[model samples]
Target chain A: MTRPSPKIGVYGFTGCAGDQLMILNCEDQLVDLFGATEIRSFVMAKSDNHEAELDVALVEGSISTEAQLKHLKDIRERSKVLIAIGTCACWGGPQAMKLGDGKFEERYKKVYGNAKITVSKAIEGQPLDAFVKVDMKIPGCPIDKQEFLKSVSKLVAGKHPYLLKSPVCLECKWKENKCLLLDGKFCAGPLTKGGCGAVCPSHNLPCVGCWGPTDDLNVSAEYDLLKEKGFVPEEIITKIRKFGGSGVMELVKNLEKKEAKK
Target chain B: MMILKMKKEDLPAFLESAKEWGELWGPTTKDGKTSYAKVDSLSQMDLKATRTVIPPKKFLYPPRFTMFDFDEEGFVERTGDVPKRILFGLHPCDVHGILIMDKLFLETYKDPYYAERREKTLLLGHSCIPDDKCMCFATNTDFVAEGFDLFFTDLKMFYLVWVGSSKGHDLVRMRADLFSRNLDKNDILNYTEYRKWKTAQFKAKIDLTGMPDIFELGYNSPIWDELGEKCLSCGQCSMVCPTCNCYNVVDEVDLGTAEGTRDRFWDSCMFREYSVVAGGHNFRDKRADRLRLWYTHKLQAFIGEFGKPACVGCGRCVATCPVDINVATVSTALKEQEVGK
Candidate 1:
């Protein structure tokens, strides 16, 4: 007997729908993806998206508004498994860089001014885990296309998708690219999670840490290396904070605490 | 082992004739970085290069490759298609690295992938000038005796070539006029002088004496933690090291299909995920623990098992590591109980 295809829903909240676009960009694999899985809801790809119970929910973007927070809860309630896709949904992306900085009000006012009544009140951007449980995370600025496809296939086959947790340096070395840090560049390859195939470094550009921090990130070491290379503390922090989001912020805070105790 | 001499000018003609054996590959410099690339003749190669960015192991065991293509029915081994190639300009330490690899991949369980590539490829060793990073003297691998088909030693006016195997002799026979077996007293004196000059040129003083004992004594030392903190865990040292041969395998399924190809890629013990197993139990979860395992394996465990350290002292780690955490630094730190800059 043939197994029934998993019912999947793809959703976007506040950030650019780049992850969903990445899925669409898999033009060669799209036909097979459509044929194998019952894509019950993919608003970006199809119009007739039903908000029904789903076996898996591929969620992209951060919960920035009250409506999105509510929508995320509803999505979690309707889905058996919710995998956060993209840096935005995984760690609040660049939008949540200043999270807990206590300057959101001033920044919001500066950007949006005094707008009248809105459909949903704007709130501080947060990852899906802030409201509901996130079963897994497929991280990138826009989620990597091959990783997205692999994750979907693994989930469909009733297997856990394995994500590479190593830093970008591994892939950089595999590509045989010269280390930018060795050349006195402020490369984030050693601190950021890989799986982008070391794309930036392969092209002679430094990694921007867009895939977020690796689990075993050596923040202080990276900071020290950059500092030794003549990068100011402020410049290093800004570079790390660009896509590091809440995960790296927590690590940095913990590092500071450890250092203080020392 | 037939020792012959060829004039420096006739070397290019000999190399041109040697191409009949396979695709000639040698160290070629690009953008100030040297790596092995296909070359037409000796003139296209940077024979003076100290070391290639990636070692000769890449030709035998590639960074990544498909092992098998499988559907729902069965797995079809993706063997064959390995082209016959000649790898030229391998330094003595690199040839020693290949010998260690032979003991690992060509013996015991025997990896067919590495075996197939090894069978097809021929190693052509070349003499090298000792740079500041060269530590092969400490490892006693500065002059290789085996593991290469041919070895060429530059004696300024002429090249003293050692025909290591029958294949090398065949290549020499192809260009018989370019080579001469006649050797005078001056050739021996010149070779001795060259060895003396090479020995004095080593600037990196890496002594691996009693490494196993030192590693055992310093098992729980705080130095591991200190080095771990500094280590990026980038695995660049492993990638560039001539003797590092760790690999990881994965089955990549095609989208929406059960069919896929099983692929093998270079893996490093430095990676946090390397020691992770089922049910989320990471054996070497701490970077310190991982760092200790890598060094212990290279300097201690491999010594116990193979009677020699896994590190060939090619100085790839010295050149590659960004934060100064290499065999030289780590071993020195263990021995001296102090980390060096």
Candidate 2:
């Protein structure tokens, strides 16, 4: 007996819809993707979206508003498995760089000076795991297309997706690219999680840490290396904060704590 | 070993004739970096290049390639289309590196993929000038006698060619007119003088004497943690090193169908996931542990199994590592019990 196709719903929240656009960008595999799964609710892809129970819910963007948070909780209740797709949902993307800085309200006032009424209350951007249980995460500034497809295929087959946890340096070395750090340049390749194929380094550029921090990274070592290279501590932190989000923020904070003890 | 003398000017003609056997590949310099590239003739090659960014192992086991294509029926092994080629300009250290790989891949439990590539490709060794980073002298891989089909030792005006295998003799026979069998006493004296000169050219002093013992004794040393702290875990050293042959295989499935390709890509022990087995238990989770494993395998474990260290001392690690955490530094640190600046 043939089993029915898995019901997958792709949703987007506060950030730029690049992740959703990435799904649409799978034009070549769009037919195969549609044939392989029942896309019950993808508002950007289809007008007729069903808000019913889903086998898999792929959520993009971070929770930055009360409405988005409530909607995410509802989606979590309805979906059997929830996957955070893109850096925004995984680590709150660049938007959540200042999440723990305690300046969200001040920054909000700086951006939009005291607007009277609003459809939803504004809040600091935070990853999906901050509010609800995220089964898996496909991290990137915008998730890699091939990685996204691989994750989807595994999910549809009822298997756990195996993502690489190595840093960008692995991929960079595989590509035979010269290490930017050797040139005394600030490169985040050693600290940033790979699966981006070391795209920036392949072009002779330093990694921007857009995929967030890898687990158990030597953050203090990287900081010290950068500092030794004549980069100021503030400058190094700013560069890391560009796309490092809360994951890297926590690592940097721990590094600071350890340094303080010394 | 059949020794033949060839005039330096006749090299291009000999190489041109050798192309009839297979596609010619030699070290070619581009953008200040030397790498092995397919060349039509000797003129396209940079024979003076001491090393390529990647060694000849890439020809046998590529960085990444599809091992097989799979479908609903079954998996189809990808064996065909491995082109026949003559890889030229390999240094003595690189040739030694290939010999170690041969014992690993072609010996017990032979890897058919590597075997096929090895069978198709012919190794042509060349003499090199030792730079400050070259450490083959310490590893005793500065002079190779066996592994390659042909080894050309450049002695200024003339070339002393050693034909190692029958395949290499066949290439010589194809251009028998260019090679001279007439060896006089002067030629022997010239070769001796050349050997003395080459020996004095080495600048880097690396002593791997009792490396296995040193590695064992320093297993619990705090030096590993210090080295690990400086190591980026980029695996660049592994990639550039001639003997690192670890790889990971993944079965990629197509979106809608139950068919795709099984890809094999280079993996490094420095990577955190290298030791992670099923159930998420990481065997070498700490960077220090991974660093120790890499050095131990190269210096101690391989010596225990093969009676020789795995390191060819090609100096690729010395040149490639960003933070100076290569074999030279690591070995020196172990011996001195202090991390180098």
Candidate 3:
């Protein structure tokens, strides 16, 4: 007997929608995906979007507004497996850096200039997990196509998708590119999670921590490392906070406390 | 070795004739970085470049080398699909690096995949003039006396070619029109003098006279932690190092299908996952431990086993590392520091 086709929805909130574009970038592989599962909703690709319950929901972007939060919770209730796609959905992305710096209001006012928006009320962008539980995450500035296919195929087969817990340093080694960090440029490959196939490093560019911190990253040690390398405390924190999200701020707090005690 | 001379103007024609050898690969500029690539024409080759961003080792040992295809009915071995090729204009250090890798791949348990590529490929070595970043002189790999099919040293208006092997002699004979019997005694004298002058040009130096002893005694040195603090554990050193042949074998099964493949890709000792074993225990858990292991392997363990350190001092690692965590600096630290009580 043929297995029932999986019902899936792809949604976006407050990000570049680059992850959605990446899914479409899998042009040849998307045919296989289309055959294997029923794509119920993907506004980026098709117009016929369904509102019914889904077996799997791949969400892109972060929750930055009350309206987006409501929509995210609704999607969570309807989907059995909710996978956060992209750094925006997974770790709040670049927008979350202001929150980490404790200058969100200042930055927000600078942009909007005291004008009250009548549309959706804006809150600091947050990872999908802040509002509802995300079953899995595919982290990247824009999610990698190969990784997306791997996870989607696993979900289609009713199996749990596995991701490497190691940092980008692992893949960077495989590619054998010169380390950007060794040139005295700050690279976060050792701290950020592996899965993007170390793309930026392969091109001899520093990893901007777009994939967020790895599971076992020693943030305090990394902080000390930057300091030892002659980077100012503020400079180090700001560099990490580029894509580090609020978790980096917590690590900074812990590091400051440890330093004070010493 | 049969010594021959070829004029600079005849290089295009000579390279064009070299097509009979197989696919010609030499350093070419791409994306503002010089890397070894397939040269379709004379203009595509940049033999004058100091060092390529990536070495010629990839031709012999590909990044993703497939070992076999498997199913429930055993496996089908991935036989020699290697094309006949010539890796031209390889720097002396890179040539030396290939020789070092041969110790591992060509000896003991022979890797058929690597062996096939090795057998099919011919190395055309080139003499290099060292820049500030080079330490090949300290590593004694600056000038290769052997282990190449042909070695070319640029001599102003001409190229002094040393046909080192029977294969090289065959190629030279095939393109005899490009060669000249007019090569005089002074040309040979100039070649020797130029090599001596080129060797003296290297600025970076590391005294590896007591490396094994230093590495052994400096096991508990605080330098490892200091270096570790700066290291991103990105494995860029090993990746760019031509002699680094470490890899992980993985059996990747196609989703919803029984067919699978046994593939091997490059692995790094710097990675935390590299030391992780069964039951989820990582022996080299700390970043410092991993960094120490990498340095020890390159400078000590390999030397103890192979009678020579694995590094060829190509300066690729020095030039590529983002944090400027140089191998020479680490070696100097080990040599200068005394073992703490």
Better of 1 and 2 by DockQ: 1
Per-residue lDDT of candidate 2, residues B1-341 (tens digit) = 99999999999999999999999999999867788899998889998878888888999999889999988788999998899999999999999999999999999989989999999999999899888889888899999999999999998898999999999999999999999999999899999998898889889878999999999999999999998888777777888889999998887776666777888888889988899899999999889999999999999999999999999989998888877888899999999999988
Candidates 1 onward: DockQ, in order: 0.64, 0.58, 0.29
Score candidate 1 by DockQ. Answer: 0.64
- Per-residue C-alpha lDDT of model 3 across residues A1-262, encoded as one tens digit per residue: 2568899899999899999999989898778788788989999999989989999999999899899999999999999999999988988888887665567777789999989899898888988988899899898888887778777766665656666666887677655455565466667887798888898888788888889877656666667656766788878777787787755768767777888898
Q: In model 2, which runs have C-alpha deviations exceeding 4 angstroms? A: none
True contacts kept of each: 0.53, 0.50, 0.34
- Candidate 2 chain B least-lDDT 10 residues: B251-260
Largest DockQ belongs to which candidate? 1
Q: Give the root-mean-square deviation of each candidate in angstroms.
A: 1.7, 1.7, 4.8
**lDDT, residue B50, model 2:** 82
Error of 2 at B8 (Å): 1.3
Instruction: Evaluate all candidate structures by whole-model CA lDDT and list the values in order.
Output: 0.88, 0.89, 0.80
* Least well predicted 10-residue stretch by lDDT in candidate 1 chain B: B250-259
Give the C-alpha miss distance for residue B327 in model 2, angstroms: 0.6
Looking at candidate 1 chain A, the ten consecutive residues that score lowest on lDDT are A251-260
DockQ ranking, high to low = 1, 2, 3
Instruction: Give the interface-residue alpha carbon RMSD of model 2.
Output: 1.9
